[model samples]
Target: MTAASIVDPMFISGASVWPLVEGGKGVAASNGTSAGAWAAAGGVGTISGVNADLIDDNGEYVPLIYKGRDRKARHEELVEYSTKGAISQARIAHELRQGEGRIHLNVLWEMGGCERVLTGVLEGAKGLIHGVTCGAGMPYRLAEICARHEVHYYPIISSARAFRALWKRTYHKFGDWLGAVVYEDPWRAGGHNGLSNAESPDQPENPFPRVLELRKMMREMGLDQIPIVMAGGVWHLKEWMNWIGNKELGPIAFQFGTRPLLTQESPIPQAWKERLLGVAPGEVALHQFSPTGFYSSAVRNSFLNELYERSERQVAYSDDPSDADGRTVFLPYGRSNHGVYLTPADHARATAWMVEGFTQPMRTPDGTLIFVAPDRARQIRRDQADCMGCLSHCRFSAWKDRDNYATGHQPDPRSFCIQKTLQDIAHGRGDPIDNQLMFSGHNAYRFGQDPFYKGGFIPTVKQLVQRILTGE
Candidate 1:
């Protein structure tokens, strides 16, 4: 019952592993290099988000060679890209397999052709990948899919209740092959957070009791021995040692998200790494403005700053004519200029941008757009037409097929295309301020309190894992 009595399990599902898990990040943050480094340290590492097919010929990312007439004829081109990427990642893991650490892949549940993409990676990566982690929606069939492929499966969840639902309906029979469960703090994690609108964004519950409850639920279902990986805002291990060896908590583990981002091998832009160094505690915020409709954490980059400012000045409206309705009205861009309410400063900024011909066009769910730039607009249109149908209802495609119902609302300008921003950031876009949508944990400010990290030195995966494991 005591925190000191918690037990940190060495491995999950009979696989050799460390107590730490290198949390999977999307858009190339957690690549083969970072994952390989973590696996080399005897911990589990996950590479995720459309695993880059960028290969090295002589220690450099090389372009694949393909000949095609049209897009369909380019099938071989895309397949070659995917194969090269999967192979590079597998080779990296193989190089570090001697440490007896486990290697895994985390795939987003909503990504297009999830089954084919995962199967491709697994088939290409046969012996190297030990497990698969999935989240961002209930992966009801993931257990069966991974089971068929003979790989362990971990479903990332925020609450014990959600796990119970999944177990009863899907994973309960899988038993030993179920691997470990990852409990990511919905309010404090980077990337797509799992919190719903009903939950209080400002108040986060202490994870210790929540995790214990998860253990108890697992016990009731005859799954008590499974490890629970704690993720989100986990930095110092010494502070968490108090939870080690606790009986009520059962087998425990920790997954680090933002902390891993500062590692030298992490494939993020240098400017982004430097930004995290200067972040103060409470500087990172959990906001619910993502196009995916999920809450995510990030430092106040220029993109986020503009979003926050616009939201703060946002006024609500109702159809009632009475002023007593307490509803304010807003005008659609390029519509009647009157009755449009905006803060004086915001109005001025919008007016200036418009006057300078920097117009904001409607955006699609996939982030494609018809902008003023003719060439760029053409590209956006092409990209939109080439939709992989990644999301259930892509706002970009204006694709809606639910009972033939339609919102008829155009794409939102308030939100930028996630694919574009994340891609740019991952590929080393120099403008950290303008282009990238950086994600971080709420505890990012603590970096300033630690004297050893003064002015920020990018630590390698080995250094971070060692620090956490040794309770430093």
Candidate 2:
């Protein structure tokens, strides 16, 4: 894909930089090195503040090792770790940026103790980060927090409606610090998507109309000067030539989230980079199995396949014998041999599964039992026990940050421990890469199809940015 279209420099975060943004990825995929390199290349670089990594004074990587006895204590530990990691990464990015471009911190609003982590990092690393881009939820307090820190705020929204709610509720008062509006296409973006209940997962809307709506809303709110960062599925600039200088979508920029993963500056492991080139079209799909309760797109590897199969082996059971189907067949689950009511067909299925080594029937929050192998069941229970409160409220573990520290429901076995799997994949830990979660944008398939990336050639951050500028 080629075009003669040119992208002009845009003013963002008190600086004039290329209208190219490095979309932030989580679990150490996009870190200080990558963000700094991207900023040095004249683009707005983003450091993912989600469970970022840290380096000790000796310049050695310090592993995240939790020492808490309980989930609450570990949750506190995670907050501290995130705060320190963000500060450390910001300092690195600030130093490597050479006083050019902008360094923005990206965070998920659904992360555990998000406010505490953000405030703590800002307090510790003052003046290091020029802006903050947040999404994964309605972060109504983000604008005020950024204003207090004298940094710009970029709210990542999937629709104009979400941006309007934020502006009216909180951002309007701190309009001075509202740097940009990141329109992350929930249908095409990687990691956690921001699709609202009104949107359909199977139907992907054209981004042009959605962004136009957001720009119109901003214009009505006297925010026409604000730029809209188009993130997700942005592979070639030529594909977006029409949107470059479109008046209806004022002050636009493209954020390359998936395209940057294969760059030399990317913090992802070499194997992960290689794996990206092998992704085929239709392999990545938006699924609602995340513990955060948000839909995310990922490759259908063995890890995801297991989750898919786990959900398939489910059967709803009634604890009360007076169910509408009457006193039905019994399913003896758990070590106590407690019996639950199951319909005749479901009973047959459960019996077949039990015979086929799925002897463990774990209860879900939705009053259904999902059968799994005994070892798998134990792993699920262990992961639940080892939860560190990664999210504000994790449906998988029934761990909520407020009230009784639980979601008032049984822990679900359908979802795996995201923290553990992400950390494992990021650090190239013991698990095989296929058994861990690997995030990728819907356009990851193009990496293999594109000739520039042929023969395993990976370009530097500057090279990648320059190539994108060529409308390739």
> In candidate 1, what are the lDDT values of residues 1-472, reduced to their tens digit?
2242222438654564667888888767787788888888778887773545466756577644446654333433544565567567666766755656788888877554456667778787787788899888788888888888889999999989889889989897776679889998887777788886678988888888888888999899887778888888687777887566677887778888878888888888787777777887676778766655667788766778766643443333332333464333332454565334434444455455446554543343332222233343454466544433344344444333233322265544344456556667777754554446887787777766666476676677887776666565
Candidate 1 ranges with C-alpha deviation above 4 Å = 1-9, 51-53, 56-59, 62-84, 310-409
User: For model 1, what is the alpha-carbon lDDT of residue 339?
Assistant: 38
The CA lDDT at 199 in model 2 is 87
| Cα lDDT computed for each candidate against the true fold | 0.68, 0.90
Best TM-score among the predictions, by candidate number: 2
TM-score of 1: 0.80
User: lDDT at 347 for candidate 2?
Assistant: 93
Model 2 bad stretches (over 4 Å):
1-5, 322-327, 335-337
Predicted candidate 1, C-alpha RMSD? 5.7
**Candidate 2 clash figure, as a count:** 0
Model 2 lDDT per residue over 25-138, tens place? 988989888999999989999999998888666657887788999999999889888889888898888888898899999999999899998999889889889999999999
